[model samples]
Target: MNFRACFVLLAALVCLASPALAKTPVIGVNQFVEHPALDAILKGFQDDLKENGVVVEYKVYNAQGNVSTTNQIANQITDDDPVLVLAIATPSAQAQVAATRKNAHMAEVPIIFSGITDPIGAGLVTNLEQPTANVTGVSNQMPMDKHVAMIKRFMPDMKALGVLYNAGEANSVSNVRRLKAAAEAQGIELIEATVANSSEVTQAAKSLVGKVQAMYVPTDNTVVSNIETVVKVAEESKTPFFCADTDSVRRGAIAAVGLDYYEHGKQTGEMARRILAGAKPQDTPVEFQKTLQFYFNPKAAQRMGLQVPQEIVESADVIIGE
Candidate 1:
């Protein structure tokens, strides 16, 4: 080919690829757990944002359940000066908030959080529908009304419900309130048993012995970090327990009808994409998942001597190995 023609062809190719060559929207993700529901949320968030034409460059960071480490990691995250951040869980979300709050210059960097039960209660925002600041995102905080429905499906005769949660966490408090309301609406008595820290889960679970018909474990950071202890106690007591997260179901809980946390991440990703597309976080309304998931553990059911209806089991996207 002639030199001029070759040059023209090459120029055309570069011009055509301009949009694809654009710098990806740099985003930092802070996560405290590597569980399935949360993983699903992240996967969905990434896929949705990328599919929407956002060029996102992701740097996934794990906080390892240490608030101090999470805070430190968030500080390091800001060093990259990412255009946006996705905080996966409560601690991760708070870490992002702390990092942004600690530095005035980076205040404009918008954060979209997922898996946070109560953004306002957690002091992340002033309101849900209309965030009055440079932050907004989706929440995988399981709906209490839905948990009530799940309970009825599993144990039609269940009259009393017990909840174990971390009393200090805003998300746990929000969940417990909603859970109590759901139990009330369903005409069931609700019992409260709480732990102050990871070391207190066994004692907390033991406290619920014979006082409640069934137990509901909220997606509290403290309880989740120590699920095995609670599981062991419940197993020994033969008390049927339900988790607020799918991961808990997989690990041991009989079942959980809750938000698919990872999908929550994907949903958050969509929100982040919108902000990256020039939509201000303050202008964008808080997003909620339109769908929920039911994760059941056949093994947990068998061990607890609980009979989960086959229909419900069949409906589960996940049935942990018995």
Candidate 2:
């Protein structure tokens, strides 16, 4: 073959053998801690995006239940200038919002949050219907009235209910406040034991042992990260332990009427899809989990010195530890 022919043939081979130079969008994720519910949410988020043909790269970060570390992670994510940010919990979401606001370069990067109990109360957004900013996501806010009624179902004659949570988490604080009002309306006194961090959770749970008939845990990252400790305390004390997330029921809580966090993450993922497809976060309304699921663990109930109600067993969406 002539030199010209060989050159053309080499060019063709290079074009065929070389990889495509398509740029995949990068998505930064800041998860506050590692737990069953939050892990499920991240899974659902990734699966939904994949199923919907939203090809992207992920830069995942876990704060491991540290507020300062969450802030640092958020700043690092901002510096990465990802196409978007997915904040898993209230603290992570708040940190991302703060970091983005401080860095003008990331001002346009949209943030979608999941597993947040109270977005408005967390200061993530001012209005749910009209976000009016570059932040909007899903709220896993449990129905306070329904939750109170559910708790009452297990302890009909209970005069007091104990709650353990981290007072610093805006979502937990909001949940506890609403729970208190609902409990009071039902003539049940709310006994609160606030913990500043996960290490303090066991002691906090012990404090409420005899003072209350049963113990409850909100969707607090700090409390949920160290849930087994609380479970141990409740099991030894014969105090029925309850949770606000269905995943916790499997982890040892007696029962819960809570959102399916996987579905909640998918909802947030849909919002993210829209944002990536040219929808402004300011125009997109914040979403909430549409369906709530009832879950129970018979063995957990037994360990906490309680029996699973027949009605609850029959009606539970998920019945584990049978």
Candidate 3:
């Protein structure tokens, strides 16, 4: 073959390999559902990477609030051979961890997670400093005591607080336990209701209708998605509702003081950048995000015949119309 023809062929091959040669990486993001909370997180993650000059192709996997779908999406994302992966919620993160543990293909891919309230309680890692596994990530952990405090502010004479959680979710279990402890410490009683899925939420809520003076809604995905039913039951019975997720406040809860999951996503991206830059997963510290925000819905408060205190109203980051 002539030298000129051989040189031309070599140039074409190099051009074709340019993507692999580039320092920028392809990142896979797994979102549990299309809920407003998780969608904000996806936006923050994408925005951070774009600003940092990192070439990232993100695939948002919506589990549609199904654990089975979360597992399936995790498997599909792992097959794409991304440099790293980001799981948006607790279920999605757990599903990704399960897929990576069982397989050899994604064994080396670093994982970052956001919107998870309790990474350790969920079995995602052994320690906060070092993950001791292929996965390390950020947590949108809300302060349980602070949440109860906010609840008390609205209902100064509050007692017999009802809490709804998904018994199957470790994160929910952890949060509920904290809620129980906090309620006891404040001289308030806790009424517990465990719902397996969205289908059972309304019935579970009805059980709490006349028994509890107020309801505490934690960051349970199942209950969060089915909040309208809970709201319907609670409002009709003059039972006040409180929440731990900011989105829940928008969805009709009386108030919320919790982690900003979207900011938590940007925090996740910072760790992801470090992992992609050759740091081991264990070397990076797992972060518990501290950006808690408060939202109060005066309409819901009025519906329950409750008046929020002046100081508590001033503490709100966002206030809804009454």
Which candidate tops TM-score? Answer: 2
What alpha-carbon RMSD in Å does predicted model 1 have with respect to the real structure?
5.6
TM-scores for all predictions:
0.83, 0.93, 0.91
Candidate 1 per-residue C-alpha lDDT over 1-322 given as tens digits, one digit per residue, 9 for 90 to 100: 9999999898778868896654555788888766666677788888987788777688888866667788887988899878988888777888788889889877899988888888888888897878857888887666788888888888888888888887777788898998888889989999998887678889988899799878888878778867888889889999988888778887788888777665666667767767887998988887777787778888888898887677887888766773
Give the least accurate 10-residue stretch of model 2, judged by summed lDDT: 15-24
Cand. 3 TM to true fold: 0.91
- Candidate 2 or 1, higher lDDT: 2
- Each model's lDDT: 0.81, 0.91, 0.84
Best by lDDT: 2
Clash pairs, model 2 backbone? none
lDDT score of model 2?
Answer: 0.91
Model 2 lDDT tens row, 1-322: 9999999888777767874644568999999999999998999999999999999999999999999999999999987779999999999999999999999988889999899999989999999998847899888988787888998898899999999999999999999999999999999999999999878989999999989999999899999988899999999999999889788888888889998888888888888999999999999998888788889899988888897668877988888965
In candidate 3, what are the lDDT values of residues 134-160, reduced to their tens digit? 888888777678888888887778778
In TM-score terms, candidate 2 sits at 0.93
